[model samples]
Target: MAGGEETRKSTDSLAQESSIIDTFAPEARFECPICLAWLRDPVVTACGHRFCRGCIYSWLEREHACPVDNMKLDVEKDIFPDNFTRREISQQKARCPYIVRGCIEELSPLDVESHMIICKFRPPELPENEKLRCQFVDVGCTDKFEDEPELQRHLESEVTKHLSLLSQAYTKITISNQASTSAIAQQANFWDPPAKNEQVSTSEADEGVNALLRAMYEKIVVLEQKSREQDIIISNMSEQINSLNLSMSKMQLRHCNGCYLWYINDFKNKIKDMQKDHHLMFYSPGFYTSANGYKLCVRLNLSPRDPNYIAILIHMMKTEHDNTLEWPFSGRLSITVIHPIESYRNIKETMMTRPELEAFKRPVQDLNPRGFGYTEFVLVEDLKIQEFMRNNTLVIKVQAQPV
Candidate 1:
């Protein structure tokens, strides 16, 4: 009976595969359904369909969709250029043969073969004058100029800004080193506590002041050595923990259905780092609600408007299933900042999607231009939420579902 069930399942999968194969032609990817020929200036619809530009215009004039699927297709809102398909078809047929040899040119398929014969061979590398970047790029100067004169002019004009960036970088390094030293000092304090002088005054007098000082000095030396050893061990342990955290971020702890948990490591340090680079953002790994469901990830950063709070935003990323998903997403998002030690103390915030707002609209770019979320999710120094972080790590859980 088990063997029969397995055979039936295998047979069902093969039948479905065969049906899909029948729906597409040998080179159906490049062929338009209406024109019965290779595609020319193709445009894709949000219905997970595409057509030649000329054919789509003709079809949309008569009805709102292609004759085959009849699914709704709007020219103004739903249609977009399929850049992948465009590049694939263009390069395969019209690209110059010497592009690999550094010939930066493309021609129509009819004229490509003849043009290749006359094209000159270009050197592998371009001249330095053709491309350049600021020398202070290491310290975070991201500016572009048209030419050498423009770059020189920018350098002359922005002397103060560049010097300030260098100073900030140096200051950050100093603070980081000092923080590490203070942490070691705290550990040493934990291991050694002073004797209660009130009760032991007479006992210390019997030992003599000079002799007692020598003993105390010797003990301090031993404790310092021991602290150094412990610091090395802790440094190694921190590296291992960092590697594990990276793995967890890339591939979550387990498969999720419609919820995701993001771990923000070194929370306090991140809050400090935000002061140096206001645009710095932390993105959680991407996840989906279900199979062929909405793809999303959380964007977190110190609130731009008010640095006292952190901003949490959700973005709708482009996926293969994007064209088929509902637009102006109607759902309720339940976001929670989980307490590391106590479950009951978790901070939960809820927001429902507003159809009138652009934040929940279908994505046009790789990630939607508009993100839906709270600007000030929580206060940075709230006493009740201080315990939400453990071992300097903060955890956030986000759940999305239809309203």
Candidate 2:
């Protein structure tokens, strides 16, 4: 019986403590309908309803009716401060919501809101299962994982891919930075300002001018360097194009059986220097006769050793397929000195090669010394006539026919 009575007394004490807490607890009427918390700065509506002044004011912005009664309300005239209700709430003692989290302080209604904002025990608004994104999101890593551990694992697994993306981004940034730096460097005014007249001195003026000139010179040098680089690249490309053309011509010559025509422009200018020089002669580069591969060239002497007239010659040259060709060549050649005036007839000359002629024979070396030609091909004075010289240019045409 003694043990049972002691147990009952312990239960009574617990019941009494619970009763005391209920007696001090804020009533539902003292709570705001919007926040469901003890009203702060309590205000009463025309319908005799109480709510926190801030809550009602914010609600009235989006609505005209009261949250509880759904009755029409006016924010400017229907709500009045209830100082009595505010005082009652402030006087009531409230246990901290974080009591379970080890908060030991008791607070009034007025201080609870401020405490909760800084409370360490407040539950996180976001759920723990929600994913976290990568810190490198700006660089294009869009990966999200359940938590920090998973995110770390993802980063480790994709390290190579991430590094490559970072490298590309870094390269772009570097290029942009270089361009910006170059632009800034070119603007001399951005770095130095003009001096005032009163502060100017002969030495100072000279230094400033020299600095400006130096900046200008540096910019010019950079531009000139870029221009030279571009020129070199263009020259290389031109050389390659010419090489390709020469190769294509050689290939076509191996299969072509048709006669080849050669046209030389600015003929007078080309021979003028040769005429003045003791050399007195000009030789064209070799060209193929036919697919059988007979190579020949045309030569001109402005002032021959004879000195009476202009000399013309035709000679044979070594060829890769010389062994496959007829030993002594037999062909016809035509040369025309075109008159600049369209009305004038062109001067023409023709020659028929024979197997017995040394000029028609296969070359022993790269070229032969003896060639077939007329020493008195044309009068030198006739070539100097105005009709043959137009705009300081002359045109010569040569055709080779292989039978």
Candidate 3:
């Protein structure tokens, strides 16, 4: 009775933690079980629960059970990308993070950051009432709309009109400043002190010149602001693209039907760099043994003891299937250095999972601290002479399966 009561309490606590719903979104379905937040890059488990890709991976590093129910899950087979849920969550309207500062704009996830970049309310000094002005009101343009989308459309459609206003201002400023060019050149702005001999600009004509200069300065400031916004948008887009590319590449490596190939590029540079950094190493993206099997990764580095040779190690990675799969996983893990045109020249080694070794046991962390494999996989000179490398690139294939 005591053990059963304890189990019930544990289950109830996990359920409560996982159910901390996000009130910001329209529905609770988008919340990640592990993160207690809106799921980004969501994935679904076989049990039909959704989680953020990163959150689930991090969670599985320590616990092999589902966050919601403590049910076992297989990282390889049970987990699938929840594209539908991701789309739904992204499309759901969300308020600006700066909404507390008077930004009344609500935007989809896709446009929120870009909108935030140019949000007039984002300026701390601007009053709530002042942020309601049109985007170009400072540039001699009329305030036409108060609606955010309507304001955007007006800005887009009225570019010519806005330009005309600027041109007219520039022309007027040019004519007015002609008489004061010498005076203006001597001083920077209305704020700047006059020359020792010159008087203060309180006269009507002098006031007119200062106003034109201020208008010109406003135009310059607006242009600079627009340029910086573009730069931020570009930087954000670049980061998103890089992240997408990285995720795609890792997925390709992680889910390649169990047979994984690692391409070591700039081989000569690696060798040279290895000399300076004796512990220099490269890790292959984590791969699975089967669709529902053990997750593993390979490590390659130059032998610290024998500089002429390379070292290779295979590490068991913690996965959601830890509870279901065999502990001290039994299998034959092999690594082969390929000689594409000459199959016989490939250097190969096969290691059996020793039951007594910690390297073969269920990983206690995201990656097992202990690794098993060859310390001297092959000689550098031998690989160079054996037609092992192609285009300064070396390829290795790793395969794991039950005996």
Q: TM-score per candidate, in order?
A: 0.37, 0.40, 0.43
lDDT at position 258, candidate 2? 33
Candidate with more favorable, higher lDDT: 1 or 2: 1
Every model: Cα RMSD to truth: 37.6, 31.7, 26.0
Best by TM-score: 3
lDDT of 2 by residue, 1-403 (tens): 4554445444433443344334344579787889876787899999999998999999999998899889999988999999998778777887655553456678886676578667675433433333455544444566765444676798888988878765654444221122222332323322222211112343343333334444556689999999999999999999999999998877655444434434455766666666677466767667776666688777777546655467777778898888898878887777777776763668888888778878788799888877887767776567776467666555656667777
What is candidate 1's lDDT per residue for 1-403, written digit by digit as tens?
A: 4554445444433443344223323267877888765567878888777678889888898898756788777778878888887776666544444443346575654345457447674212222233334545445566755444666899999999999876655444321122222332323222221211112232222222223333445579999999999999999999999999987754542247669888888988888888678898888877877767777889988888998888999987777777888887888898999987778878899888888887778777778767889889998887235677788888999998865
Mind giving the per-residue lDDT tens digits that candidate 3 earns over 21-94?
Answer: 12243346766766566688899998888888999988887898898988898888889998888778767887
Judging by TM-score, tell me the better candidate of 2 and 3.
Answer: 3
TM-score of 3: 0.43
Q: Which candidate model has the greater TM-score, 1 or 3?
A: 3
Winner of 1 and 3 under lDDT: 3
lDDT (C-alpha, whole model) for all candidates? 0.66, 0.65, 0.70
Weakest ten-residue segment in model 1 by summed lDDT: 189-198
Candidate 1 stretches with Cα past 4 Å from truth are 1-255, 383-385
Model 2 / residue 315 / CA error / Å: 0.7
Worst 10 residues of 3 by lDDT: 190-199
Model 3 has an lDDT value of 0.70
